[model samples]
Every structure is written in C-alpha cells, then in structure tokens.
Target: MKKILSILCFLICVNAFSQILSSNLEKKTLALGEVNHFIIKIDNLNNQQVSAAAKNELLPFHFEEIKDSIGTQPNLYERKIDFSVYEEGKFTIPELEFKVGDKVLKTIPYEIEVINTAQKGDQINDIMNNKEVKLEPKDYWELYKWYVLAALSVIALIVVIFMIVKWGRNKKSSPVVATNQTLKELDSLKKKKYIEEGNYRSFYVELLDISRKFITKQYNVPADVLLTDDLVQLMKTNNTISRDNEKIVEDVFLRGDLVKFAKTFPDKEIMEKDFTDIREFVKRSSNDLEFENLRKDV
Candidate 1:
C-alpha cells in the first residue's frame, strides 16, 4: 500500500507540471502590403531551454519581423511574427514546433487569405460636371486680397532685412553661439536619464530629431523631411560632410529606425557611441562651416 500511494503522488506531480502550447493569428484575411501578426505562446516553459529545430516556412507571405518576450508568468514565453503577402492568394501557415526540455510542442497549421482590393472591381464612377460660381465685388476682393497682402509682405520683408543688416554691422558674428546651443540641447538630453530608465525608444526618437535639426541647420540640407535613404543620398551627393561622418550619421539613423519601428534594443555601449558620434559630427561640421564662411568673407 505504501509503494502504490507513493507512485500515485508521483503521477499527480507530473500531471501538474504539464506544458501547454497555443497559437493565434491576428486576422485570417489581410490586404496586400498590410501586416499581420502570428503569435505563439508556451506555458510552463522557459524560452531559453526551448529549441526551434524546424523553422516555420512562410512561402507566399513575406516574413517581416519576429520578436520574443516572456509572458505574464515567468515560465510562459511568447513569440510574435509579422508577415505580409504581396500576391493575393490563400496560403497555409506551416506548423511550428519547438522542443522544451524533453517535450516537443507543436502548433497546428492554419490558412490565411491575402486579398487585393484594387483588383476587385472594374466599376468606375462617373465624374460630375463642375459647377459655375457667380462672383460679387466682395468675392473679387477676396481673390485679389492675397496679392495686396503679398505686396505688403514683400515691403515688410525688405524693411526687416534692411534693419537686420544694419543691426548685424553693429554686432559681431558668433557662429559658436549656434553650436553651443546645439551642444546644450544634447547635454539636456543626457540629463533626462532616458537610458537609465530603460526608455531607449524615446531616447532614440529625441536623439534623431535633434541630430536631424542640427544637420539641417549646419549643412542647409532637409534632413528632417527626407527619408533615411534619401537623406543619405543627398548627403553623399552634396558632399558637404566627410564620408566617415556621413557613415556615422547613417548608422545612427538606421539604428534609430530599428529601435523605433522594429522594437529592437541595441547594446548600451552602441547607444552611447551613437550619441557621442552625433555630438562630434555637430562640432566638426560647425567648425567646417565657420571656416568656409570666414573664407568667403575674406
């Protein structure tokens, strides 16, 4: 009786530690170029001990991103994968499996439908005829008032320019003032302790904003408006900054994108180096601009 009772207790304890696996899809149907999430959750398992020997095959759908995180419980792990399909069709999401300890957990395969709304219909709506409007004296004034304001604006701008030039002759040029203000902004960002608080996303956002503004001001380039590739291309084409400095800025911008959009956290050392690189770029670029200005003046 003692041996039978001990065996029963062991079986009960084994049942209590049973592993669970589940999978979920955000949506069954998605438009072309639209993203969807596929999530896999495992309970009573540590992700570190789990090995994905067979990779999930996403044939029709293009795999965009994948991220994993611990769930509500310490023993629970969750993985999210982002995918999109360019061609419209029904595709099967292959079964995913992972080995946790001695047990292998598998997720059942599911079908996802990809759709293209643009090719759905050929019906074209008729274009309505334009309506004619009668204009009164007030309407004429409203139309021509812009010209009047423009003339006044031009006159005001000329007067303002004259006053600025006269004031400038009395005041000595201070290029360092702008550079100092930029450096002070960087110093203020450091004081915020964003990295210490583990708010790397916000830190990168603000860092990129400040760097873009500095680039725009120092190089007279539209850094804030242009995309990363476009901005890099413009920088290379203009050759206002050295290739090494441009590469540094490009790397920082790409890392910022990964942090902001992809939810990736880079190494703390890399983050610090990016900040330092941007600071050095500002100072070096400013000095170069000042030298060029002085040469022009001479």
Candidate 2:
C-alpha cells in the first residue's frame, strides 16, 4: 500500500509542473511596412531567464524590440516580440521554440497577410510622390554605389581628424580654475529633482563626486579615491583649507558618508546647510588662490 501511494504522489507533482506555450497576434492583416505585435506566454514554470528567440526562418520579417519579461504569477511569464515583413503575401509564423530546463516548448504555427490598399487607379498611399511610374528593371545601386561608399569614408576620416586636433589644443591650454567649474557643477546639481522625489542617496552621491573631483584638481590630491577622513587630513596638512573651513568640510563629509554608506536619510534642511557650507568653502579657496598668484607676480 505504501509503495502504491508514493507512485501516485510523484505523478501528481509532475502534472503540477506542466508547461503551456501560447501566442497572441494583435492583427492578422497589415499594410506593407506596418508592424504586427506578438505576445508569447509561458505558463506554469519556475523563473527561467526568458528572452524572445524565434526561429531563423521567421526572418525577412524585422523583429521588433525584445522587451523585459514580466512575471505575473509564481510560474507565469509573458514576453513580447514585434515583427514586420516587407514583402506582401501570406506568410506563416514558423513554430517559436524555447528551451526550458531540459525540456522544449513551442507554439503552433500562425499566419499573417499583407495587403496593399490601392485599388482602381488610386495612387500608392506611400509618403512619396502621388504620380505612379511604370516599374523599371535595373540594378538599384548601380548608379551611385561607389560614390555613396566613397563619400561615407571621407566623412568618417574628417570627423576623426577634427577630434584629434581639438584634444591637442585642450591639452596645451592654461591651467583651469577648477573651483569655479566645481561650483558651477554643484549649482547645476542643486537644480535637479532628486531631493524633491526623496532620492536622498543619489543626491548625496553626486554631491560627493563633485567634491572629490574639485579636491583632486585644486590641491593636486588624490581625493577622488581617498576616504573622507584621509582627505580631510591631507587638506589640513597642506593648508589647502583654513581652520574654520575644516569643520565645515568635516560636517559635509560626515553627513554625505552617513547617507551613502549608512543609508541614513538626512533632513532637507540639514542638506541645505551642507550645500551652503560647500559653496562657502569653494568661494574662499578660490579667492585665496587668486590673491596668492597676484602676490607672486608682484
């Protein structure tokens, strides 16, 4: 009795895992150049990474975009594929086969038809000229084939040369006012909507990256890769920042680190203070550097 009961349980478990493959077509008939949507569904299976892999014969038809698969239930997934054939005729969608965990699943063959709407001396509804000309038998690319290829090659070469010259000129330019650019970047960041939407983490990350870049450029320090404490120490030892300014930097870094590393959501008011602190530090540092440069010239 026990052996018979175990066999029945195994059969029931296998039946529960059965897979169903199906397809949904948005339209059976379409105009040439128009697209048709196919939504494929696989039911009663655990998550296997699913993507639209239709057979090679289905080509000549352009497959639309491969969308991210959506799981509606524990074992239900839907994938969408859009395809269009340029030719006008009845064509059957070959069986779409998908391999799922040592098993193969496929949908039944389906058919679609393409029809041209022009009837009885009507103009071809294409966006081109209304007048219809008699079809001419000719090698389409014979006239401009070499000319088109040559023009494209020349255009590509010119773009490459221009970019090289621009990079050379910038490499030889005078030293940039790093703090001014950093301040501008911060102002632009402030205008973004991250904080308004409660994305405090992103706001903190952008703020920290700008500060690191500024420190690297201005003081010639590797602050971009340094931890907060190390960066502050380097700044103080080099006298890059003033005594009062050190406290401001420390506060900003502490708050930013809390948000980024500790996942602490800071209040908007406190974040506003950090913003003001950074702006003040940049302004003072810029003024001090400019004054020193003038004194040296004298």
Q: Rate the local accuracy (lDDT) of all candidates.
A: 0.75, 0.70
Mark the regions of model 1 whose C-alpha exceeds 4 Å error after superposition.
Answer: 1-23, 30-71, 78-174, 290-298
Error (Å) of candidate 2 at residue 233 is: 1.5
Residues forming the 10-long window of minimal summed lDDT in candidate 2? 51-60
- Which pairs clash (backbone N, Cα, C closer than 3 Å) in model 1? none
Q: What's model 2's lDDT at 223? A: 83
C-alpha root-mean-square deviation, each candidate = 10.4, 16.8
Candidate 2 per-residue lDDT over residues 1-298, each given as its tens digit: 9999999999888877787778788998988767778777888868664433323223333433333344455687777656666777887776665556556777777788888866778765667767855644455566677988999999999998899887745442222567678889988988996666555667878988888787677656798899999988887787755677677877888788766532245657777777788888877775656654776799
List runs of model 2 lying over 4 Å from the truth.
1-176, 290-298
What lDDT does candidate 2 reach at residue 125?
65
Candidate that would win on TM-score:
1
Task: Give me candidate 1's TM-score against the actual structure.
Answer: 0.54
lDDT of 1 by residue, 1-298 (tens): 9999999999988766777889899999989878888778788764346544222332222444443343445687777667677777887766665667666677888888888888556887869977999999999999999999999999999999999888855554355766777899999999998766656667898999998987777677899899999999998887777777899999999999766642245656877888899888878876567655776799
